[model samples]
Target: MFLGMAVFLVGCAKGGSSLNTVPVKGRVTLDGAPLPGATVTFSPKTPEGRTAAGMTNENGEFVLTTIRAGDGAVPGEYGVAITKPVATAGPVDDPRARGGALTPEQMAQIREQAKTKGGAEGGSAIPKKYTSPTTSGLTATVKRGEKNEFTFDLKSQ
Candidate 1:
């Protein structure tokens, strides 16, 4: 009976999940409106911490997933960085886009055009500073056994 109980207990313990992540959810807004399709990242402030990430829906709502789908994150201090990549219209009229053989001079011109197309700013909808952890000016503290909801408001200007 003692041997049977030990085996049963070990089986029960092994069958359970080892990870203990907390529920973390949040919403993102730009200038007081829902910012859809924006990616939200939570970087651990500590060296031995795990990061969590999620993307906003049409209503700017998001559910963080650390391990599995909607599994949430491990409780800790995190630096948040939100970003939205702007879509650029393809160079429809550019001959390089077509399946045509180009001369050496044409290739050089095409490279020059690509270099000057977006300029230095690159095309993010939000300020470039907000895309990095150190410059974003956002932070959060995820706790255990409680509501870990957060809301971030961003400005265009």
Candidate 2:
């Protein structure tokens, strides 16, 4: 009975090890400077599998991982999106802060207030296009058994 259990466990381990993944790492730079605290996402182009994502550290370095930490990503072409929101100076009121659905009038009032308060103050530092995978114009092909390292030079303008 012990032998059978051991064989089953080994089989399970082997099955788990069969998942295909490849290492992906990269650096992000905005206007020639390292961009920290930015989120980098890799959405598979062909629906081949799950998406892989990572956040840039202080040095603007990141490693793609999916399913498991640092396990890398499935080999395929992917659309990349990178974003970093600017910091706000003070707290802003949220329409749903009361813990219920907001009425249309309340939403309009908040929008008007935000416009008057300067909506761009706490907006994203990265270009709006770069925040969407479809519009970022960034693509990477993760090849199997190969080191997939990339450097993204983004422009704020």
Which runs of model 1 end up more than 4 angstroms from their true locations? 1-17, 89-122
For model 1, the local distance difference test gives 0.68
Would you list the clashing residue pairs of candidate 2?
none
For model 2 the local lDDT of residue 18 reads 57
Error of 2 at 39 (Å): 0.6
Model 1 Cα lDDT, one tens digit per residue, 1-157: 9999999888765431444778888999999999986667777889866666666777998777655556677889988877665756542242222323334454343323222323124466777666766677888899998899999999888
Tens digit of per-residue lDDT, candidate 2, span 56-120:
77788887666455567788988787866576765434322222333445434333322232224
lDDT of each: 0.68, 0.69
Candidate 1 lDDT trough over 10 residues, lowest sum: 91-100
lDDT, candidate 1, at 128: 65
